[model samples]
Target: MKYQVGQRITGVINKITDLGIFVTLPKNKFGLIHHKDFGANWLHERQNYHSGQAIRVVVIHNYRGKISLSKMRVNDSQLIDQTNDFLETKKENFLSVLAETVSNSQTEIKKLEQELVIYAT
Candidate 1:
């Protein structure tokens, strides 16, 4: 679906960085919620967000294949399971598994690189 300006999208929190929060949208797209878009004192307010969290945001800009998002009009229920303990636990478990997978991938990549060096020698 073509996301138009002013459209509201439901996406998953992919990652959080100093630059801003990255949201994973459908159709293999990622949207950016810049710090300025968060609101006043985003630097401090950022603490309230985390990876794997589902959030509702408005599409403020879409240019050059980059989608910019804002939480200006987002309602108080930022999360579908904001008060669900089971979902919170599931999120934690999913993150833990994802982290472990990344660690294992890194180790495998290092081994492959070392093998390549041996082959080159």
Candidate 2:
């Protein structure tokens, strides 16, 4: 069967190597799930993946009869959540810095105003 990009497919793991895992798709086509496409949990225990193990992966690229699979999408929800949390923290940090800068500017302006008043007296 011809697989297109962004298609979700299930395949059996045929071989596992240090670089990637080869999965046998329908119609004798083989797909590769690169090490980088896997999550930290899977990366740490590479041996857990063995021949004949079934897995669901997303097709990332299909070109010249070669297909690439990505398990990253399986954890996409968690990644998005983490990203949002990080952005929120950064925004809070920026706001704090801005508030401090404004306070310091106000203090300097008050000192200048007192100096001007004394000079006028």
Candidate 3:
């Protein structure tokens, strides 16, 4: 149901295969998490993902009518502070980039406006 990349959703395990696990999402939507994405220890991880189990996953890809999901990003580590720092750094970097883009766009617009005034006169 109206899935987008990077969105976190909860679904039930519909089936599991050697390649990946299929989840039943809301409104009959479906998603798959490839074996490699299950982490470095996939075989062992299989025990944790079973049929009828409810799981939370992030939408990694939603293209060409298929939705790829992942549980890796939801995983936390013992180094909670490091994880928080990393996320904060990413968010700050994104905001900085956006701000720089807006500033540059404004400067360009002002130049264009000046050129238009010259042409009008």
- Please give the CA lDDT of all the candidate structures: 0.79, 0.77, 0.80
Off by over 4 Å in 1: 75-121
Cα lDDT for residue 42, candidate 1:
87
Clashing pairs in 3: none
What would the per-residue lDDT of candidate 1 be over residues 7-121, giving only the tens digit for each residue? Answer: 6688999999988999998888889999877667888878999999998887777888799987765543442423233344565488787788799999999999999999999
Please list the residue runs of candidate 2 whose C-alpha ends up more than 4 Å from where it truly belongs after superposition: 39-43, 74-121
**Candidate 1, pairs of clashing residues:** none
Q: In lDDT terms, which candidate is top?
A: 3
Best by TM-score: 3
Which residue window of length 10 is worst by lDDT in model 1?
A: 76-85
Ten-residue stretch with the least lDDT total in model 2: 77-86
- Per-residue accuracy of model 3 over 6-106 as CA lDDT, tens digit each: 66678999999998999999989998989998667999998887899999887777898698988886553421322232345566498787788799999
